[model samples]
Target: MKYSTSPTPSLNNYPRSTSPLPAPANYQPTTASAAVKRYKYIRRLFKFNQMDFEFAAWQMVYLFVSPQKVFRNFNYRKHTKSQFARDDPAFLVLLSVWLFLSSICLGLAMTLTAGKVALFVLFVVFVDFIGAGVVVSTLLWYVSNKYLRRDQDGPDVEWGYAFDVHINAFFPPLSLLHFFQIVLFENVLFRETFLSCLVANSFWLASIIYYLYITFLGYSNYGKLVDSDLPMLQNARVFLLPLPVLVLSYLATLAMGWNLSEMLMHFYKMRVLQ
Candidate 1:
């Protein structure tokens, strides 16, 4: 967070990097399918020394404050490594660790038993984060290549990149609903008053909004590389297809007097109980 007396590259035309990052060791700019790249990426999971966690931490910080700057690196990766998906597993590893820690904190705040807390953490880290991530990423990957792309012959959106987008978008929401929401859960969000419902659901609304915006940003920048001639691309908000439905759902939740945080607490307890 320290200001440096250094000039960084401008974010305009970032996808076309003027100063690309130095490629990782053993990296080569080659056109490869996401599946193949994922195979190589997974192999490095156990190798702790090669991961750049400091850079990952920096990226995480910017993701909250200035997500645009964070994604500029993704474009740089494509410039140097021929793919938008990251090669290092450091970010994924850190996210999982954060997810685990946050889940524990949430479970404890809910006053669950130690065994139940363990079960809740397991469900969150595995089911909510990893399992659901695969489904969302695969769905977006399919949609981008099928409908979003100009044609079958054009460069397809990589599946790994779709997953990256999902995780990148997922981080802020997780911090909001999991970390920040839980911090306020015991005092504010778990109540049954109208204010409680509004505040709790507002967090839900904001979290989903953050997710959608970041997801759109991920695809929007990529869309610039592909054919942006579609009539929808006239406005800069071309990728925000879900905002209306999201707003409607948020309104419905408020009208129904649902406390989303309380619901989350009950859901976690139910998951552990069963």
Candidate 2:
């Protein structure tokens, strides 16, 4: 009855408010905060927690003291299915520390200027990280998935699984050698001696062999999809699966001219001021 003469209140009369809402008291700008958060995230990403440290230590012991146990007990497929789970980060952290220390020791041995030493170490680490960690790992995964898959019949092995197996099998011994090279053989006489080089190469070769053996075991457990009667062929195929990685590693080293002793000597000769 009150609307008798009034035009029906049109919906258009209720104009919507365009004013922006005030920022919440707790809502801080994400610009600096986002960067800080990202920095923290990256730091945390690379940081080794206690669990990681303990696992890495245990891995070293298992790899060095009882490699067979490692192959027998460690389940590569189960761990690697989730990509970068389990010992992946641990291995990376260990490798990074090893690389850093080894580079420092090598720089000192080479008597290089501090700047040169830093540059050289950075270069070597960069090259190695790219070559072994990225390129060779990718190649191994491809070879395993594309070619080696035919040899096995179990679950379809993912590239991450192969990559994990490769890293675990290879890096432990390598890291040990890196430690030894820096700690025990830092002197010029040791660096120059043929025995030292021979021993180093011998250990390197042994590590490679051990990696192949571990990879063989991993394949035996996960990759072998064939009938029970053909176990030998399955074994052989698994054994050979890592050959591609080996070849790639060798090629990479050659291409990069990555000789630890040479690198040490090159820097030593620089004799850059401290």
Predicted model with the maximum TM-score: 1
Q: Give me the overall lDDT of model 2.
A: 0.53
Question: What do the candidate models score in CA lDDT, each in turn?
Answer: 0.78, 0.53
lDDT tens digits by residue: candidate 1, 129-211:
99999999999888777777655664677778899889999999999988987776558776779889988889889998888
Q: Which ten residues in a row have the lowest lDDT in candidate 2?
A: 224-233
TM-score of 1: 0.83
* Deviating ranges (above 4 Å) for candidate 1: 1-16, 19-35, 223-239
Cα-based TM-score, every candidate: 0.83, 0.57
How well is each residue in 137-242 modelled by candidate 2, as lDDT tens digits? 6765665556655445433444445565666676655564555655765453254465555555544556677767766655554422122222212323557566
The reply for model 2, stretches above 4 Å from the true place, is 1-51, 72-88, 150-154, 186-197, 223-274
